[model samples]
Target: MEADTYTQSAFEAELPIPRGMARIMRFSNDQPTNHVFRRGAHYWLDLCLTPRPEKARGCYSERWGPHRFERLGEIFLVPPGEALHVRTDAGDNQASIACEIHADSVDHWLETPLEWTDRRLEGGLDIVHPYIRSCLSRLAEEMRHGGTGSAELAAMIAGQLAIELARYLEAISESPITGGLASWRLRLIDERLHRGGSTPSLGELAELCSVSIRQLTRGFRSSRGFTIGDHIAQTRIEMAKRALASDDSIKSIAFALGFASPSSFSYAFGRATGVTPLRFRQRHLRGRE
Candidate 1:
């Protein structure tokens, strides 16, 4: 695993990432990515392999914390200004997921058939694993060959990578969120629809907020008139409405939302809207009921 970057130069785009969209990044031993530090303004996430540097390292939010973080395999929800830093060497190495998604993106996904958002998961290095290696290998191969639709293809590959990571996190950790969820939960689950958007199956989310699942979800029905998960779904439907008004493929939309496949996305979309995502988009865009 020598250091190299498929996105060798700064890769920037103004492309429309329909709601629920996601991406995956892999850093091997060969490629040493400088690993961008994220500003909430910049992107939703920045997964990296590079670890704390021996020398001084500053990032978008604040200076790298004075801690030694080796053996990198984690997904963390960085607070507004906090950043995880990494510097490479023999035992201490560079590897990570530079995933930057937006809240708008998460909302769009809810409209489709995805189960939950990263907000639903516990953020930690334990999230990344080798199960994704095969997929990443295929993506890298595709990147090496330039052709028509390469960028779009690259985007697709990246999206799947994020989906897989999300799945992995959902499967392994039983850790609940802790602390200060009053504000964090409100902000994180803002796509409110059914209830107050406060119930707790997103075990990872519980970990992120540092609160017990019981406190987060107890008697939520009496307060919100729906289950916490239902509230999350309704909020997702609201997000789907916006995507319906935009111009994007239903397939892309479903993928962004983390459907196991497009068929699932379509099925879920139809269930929610009484029409397919495309039909909903068309009907909504044309101002038809």
Candidate 2:
């Protein structure tokens, strides 16, 4: 695959097509940048890979403030004509990938109701699923290497991405957001949890949402089928899985996630997955062999 290189404003983008229904590009910026991504006719996916995942920040809507990212491999979907503003940390070179997929390809794989095709799946959809991350990582590697069979790999990944997006939309529809809470507040809670912040009390959550505790609890339960505390635990486990896969030490990950001690973290992890963190990491590592 050949690369289409260009520079616009302060950022440089390299777009490469390797025989697929998706167009993939990598972007790099040396300084803080404010650019509105003009939408095309197709749906889009963007993933940030630089400035350390934890330090990444961006605003999907022009009206909203930027927020710190909680996990790596988070996927943001951009609907046509909608603008996304991204400003990376200063003094660090920012790296990201933006892939544009044709709507027809998505429609073919998605089994959900027909109306969801028009829902847009909302931008800034955080993707913490390991399987999706694995597929995207392979697609990215092929995009960079462009070796033999790269075209086939790219096409397969493109189709897989569409399938996953459809499944995600279906899941969201099953737990549609209820009234009584602002969207920004929900985003705030998500950001705080991903940053390893302590699980917030019901009163704290209610105050942030500007609603009574009972209403907030009822709203969350109705939408997610779980309490806020359970959601926090689940999020922390997901983050822990990512961290464990990295080179970071288990003790460090435990502390980063706000656990009282390494022992406590191990206990919690064991209880959640029926295996120790070390054993889980080892199993995953072996599977990669």
lDDT tens string, model 2, 1-289? 1022224223223334432233334334454444555455566676543222333444444444455322223455665545555444433233445677666666667665445221223323444444454556556556546777776667777778777766655555444455534557767777767767456677876777787888887776545434566667767776787677677889998988888898999999866544578875774454334
Across 68-166, the per-residue lDDT of candidate 1 in tens digits comes to: 442232234332223445444322222333444443333333324333222222233222333344334344345334478866775776566556545
> Roughly what TM-score does model 1 have, to 2 decimal places?
0.33
Top candidate on TM-score is: 2
**Model 1, CA-based lDDT:** 0.41
Clashes of each: 43, 0
Clashing pairs in 2: none
- Name model 2 segments beyond 4 Å from true: 1-30, 51-73, 85-91, 110-125, 128-130, 144-148, 174-176, 179-254, 258-289
Q: Which candidate achieves the best lDDT against the true structure?
A: 2
